[model samples]
Target: MTATIEQPTKVRRPRATLQLLRITLVLHALLIVAQPIAAGYFLAGNVDAMTDIHATIGGSVWIVAFLQTIVAACYTIAGHGRLWPTITSAALVIAEFVQLTFGYAQNFAVHVPLGTAIVTAVVWMTVWSFRSTARLSRREAKR
Candidate 1:
C-alpha cells in the first residue's frame, strides 16, 4: 500500500507583488524629492544660480514630481488588479511629456536638470508598467 501526498498552500504570490511595489516606492520617492535634494547638490557647485532657479521653479516641479511619484506607487501596489493605475499612469506619462516640452522651450539649461530626468524616467517606467498591467488585467478578465 502507498500513502497519498498533498501539496501545501502558497504564500509568496502577494508578497512578490508587494516587493515589486516597494522598489517603486524607494526609487520614486528618492527621485521625487530630488527637487530639494538636487538643489543642495547644485548649491555646492553654484549657490547663487541654483538659489534663484529653485525659488522660481521649485514649487511647480515639486508638485508634479511628488504627485507622479504617488501615482507610480499606486501603479506598483494595485495596478495589476485594477484600472485606475492604468489611467493614472497614462496621464502621468502624457502630462510629463507636456511639461518636458514646455520646460525645454523655456530653456533646459536654466531650470533644474533633475526634473527633466525624473519625469523622463517616470514616463518610461510608467509606460512599461502599464503594459504589464494591461496584460495581467486581460489575463485576469479571461479567467
Candidate 2:
C-alpha cells in the first residue's frame, strides 16, 4: 500500500468593491485637502482666481463624497466591508452639505471648524479603508 499526500488549495481574494472604495476615498480626501489650500490662496489676496477655484473644488468634493458613500454601500452589501464605513460615509456627505451651507452664509465660525473636522474624518477613513482587510465570505475564501 502507498501513502498519499494532500495539498491545500489556494484561494484568490476578490477586492473589486473594496478597491473602488479605497480609490474613491483617497480621491475624496485629496479634494477635501485642496479646499483649504484654495481658500488660503484667496485669503492671501488672490481673491478672483482662488475664489473661483475654491468654489469649483468645494463643489467637486460634494460629488466625490456622494460617490464614495455609494461605493461604500456596495462594499458593505457585498459582505466585504463593515457597517461603520458606510455610516461614516453617509454622515460625511451630510456634514459636507452643512459645511457648504455655512460657507455660503459666510459663517466662518462654523465653516472653518467644520471644514477641519471634515478633513480629519475623510483622512482617517481613507487611511483605515486602505490599511484594513475586508471580512471575506466563506464562498470567497473557498475560491
Candidate 3:
C-alpha cells in the first residue's frame, strides 16, 4: 500500500472584529491609566492646564468606550465570542458617562471612588482579552 501523508492542521487566527476589540481595549486601558496621572498633575500644581487635558481625555474615553461596545457586540455575534465582553463594554460606557457627569459637577466623593473602580475594571478587561480564554470562539469553547 502507498504511504499516506498527513496534512498539517491550519492555525486559526482571531477574526478582524476580535483583533479590533483587542486594540480598542488596550487603547482604553492606556487612557484609563492616564486619567489618574493627569489628575495627579493637576493636584500637584504642576500644570494648570492639566484639568483641561484631563477633561479632554475623559471625553475621548467616552467615544472609545462607545466604539468598543459596538465592536464587542460584533465580536460576540459575528465572531461567536463570549457575550460578557459586550456587556462589560456597555457597562463601561454608562459608568464613564456617570464619571464625567460627576466630575463636571465637582463631586469628588463619587468621582474619585468611581474612577478607581473604572480603572480596575478596564485593566482587568484588557488583561483578560489578551489571554487564551478570552480568545476562545464558540466552537473552541465547546471543545
Candidate 4:
C-alpha cells in the first residue's frame, strides 16, 4: 500500500491556535480574579502565606497572553482576518498594561479590576467579531 500525506487545512486562524488563544485569555482572566483574592488573604492574615503558585501561575499566564498578543498583531499585519484582529489588539494592549500595572506576575497584592474588566470585555467582543465577520464573508461570497 502506498502512503500518502494529507495536506493541512488552510485557515487564517487554525483551530489549535484559536483554542490556545482562548485558553490564554481564560487563564489571564482567572489570574485577574485570583490576584484580588490572594491580596485579600494577605491583608487578612500574613503576607508570607502567599506561595510561589501565585507567581508561577501569573508568569505562565503572562507568557500565554504575550503570545496571544503576538498572534493578534500577526493577524492584523497579515490582513487576513478582520473581525477578531481589531478586538484582539485592544485586548492585548489592556492585558499588557494590566500585567505591568497590577504587578500580577511580580506580586499578587496589586489587583486592578479596571484592567480586568477591559480585557474581559475585549475578549468577548473579539469572539463575537470573529463569528460575525465569518458569517458576513460567507454570505458575501455567495453573492
Candidate 5:
C-alpha cells in the first residue's frame, strides 16, 4: 500500500456580510482611538477648535457604533455567524450614548473611565474580527 499526502484546502474569502462587519469594526476602532487624541489636544490647550473637534468625534463614534450594531446583526443572521459581535456592538452603542451624556454634563468622573472602557472594547473587537477564530465557518459556530 502506498501512502498519499493530502493538500490543505485553500482559504476562502469572507462573505459580503462578514466583509462589511470587518470594515465597520476597523472604522469604529479608528474613530474610538481618535477620541482621546482630540480630547488631549483640547486639554493641552493646543487649539480652541479641539474641543469642538472632540465633541464632533464623540458624535461620530456614536453613529459608527450604531451602524456597527446593524452590520453585526446582518452578519449574524444573513451570514450565519456568531452572535457575540451583535451583542457587543449593541452594548457599545448604549455605552457611547452614556459617555456622551456624561461628557455633556461635565461628569469627568464617569466620562473618563467610560471612555477608557469603550476604547478597550473597540480594540478587542477589532482584533478579534481579524483573527482566524472569527473567520471560522457556520459549522464551527454550531459546534
Candidate 6:
C-alpha cells in the first residue's frame, strides 16, 4: 500500500489596484509610441498640421508621466507592484521633463536619442508588466 499526499495550492486574486496599474502602463506605452510618429510626420513634411500635433503629443506625454507616477504610488501603497517600477516611472518623469527642455531648445543631439531611449524603456516596462507573473506574485507576497 502507498500513501499519497496533496499539497495545498495557493490561489491569487486579481486586485483592482494592479488592474489600474496595468491600464496606466498600457496608456503610457501608447503615448510614447505616438510621440515619435507625430514628430516623424512633421519632419517628413507630410503635413504642416503635424507640427502642432507633434507639440500636442509632446505636452500630453507630461500628463501621462504624471498619471504613471500617481498609479505607481497607488500600486506601492497597495503592495501590488515592486519598488523598481515605481522608481523607474519616477525617473522617466524627470527624463521626460529634460527631453521636453532639450526639444524646446532645438537641441536635437540630446533630444532625439533621449526620446528613443524613453520610447524603448516605456515599451519594455509595459511588456514586462503584462508578462511578469513572478513579479506580480512577489509583490502580492509583500502585502
Leading candidate by lDDT: 3
Stronger candidate by TM-score (4 vs 5): 5
Ranking by lDDT: 3, 5, 2, 6, 4, 1
Per-model TM-score on C-alpha atoms: 0.38, 0.81, 0.85, 0.49, 0.85, 0.80
Question: Which portions of model 5 show Cα errors greater than 4 Å?
Answer: 1-14, 47-49
TM-score of 6: 0.80
Q: Which stretches of candidate 1 lie over 4 Å from their true place?
A: 1-13, 39-80, 107-143
Which residue pairs in candidate 6 have backbone atoms (N, alpha carbon, C) closer than 3 angstroms, thus clashing? none
Residue 121 alpha-carbon offset, candidate 3, angstroms: 0.8
What are the RMSDs of all candidates, in order?
10.6, 4.6, 4.0, 9.1, 4.7, 4.5
Give the per-residue Cα lDDT of candidate 1 at 94: 57
> Candidate 6 residues 1-143, lDDT tens each?
99999987664433665677789989989888988888888777867535577676787787788888888777766644566777888999999999888888889999999999999989987887777552464436566
**Candidate 3: tens digits of C-alpha lDDT, residues 33-134:** 999999998888867546677989987798899999999999888878888899999999999999999999989999999999999999999898888887
Model 1: how far residue 126 lies from native, Å: 14
Per-residue CA lDDT of candidate 4, range 15-130, in tens?
A: 44444445555655666556556656767886653555444554555555666577654444453444454455566666656765566455434455554554566456446544
lDDT of each: 0.50, 0.81, 0.88, 0.53, 0.87, 0.78
Clashes of each: 0, 0, 0, 0, 0, 0
Task: List where candidate 4 sits over 4 angstroms from the true fold.
Answer: 1-16, 49-60, 74-79, 83-115, 122-143
Candidate 3 collision pairs:
none
Candidate 2 per-residue lDDT over residues 5-109, each given as its tens digit: 888765444378788988998899888988888898888889874558877877678778899989988877774556678889999989999988888888999
Once model 1 is optimally superposed onto the true structure by TM-score, how far is the C-alpha of residue 69 displaced, in angstroms? 11
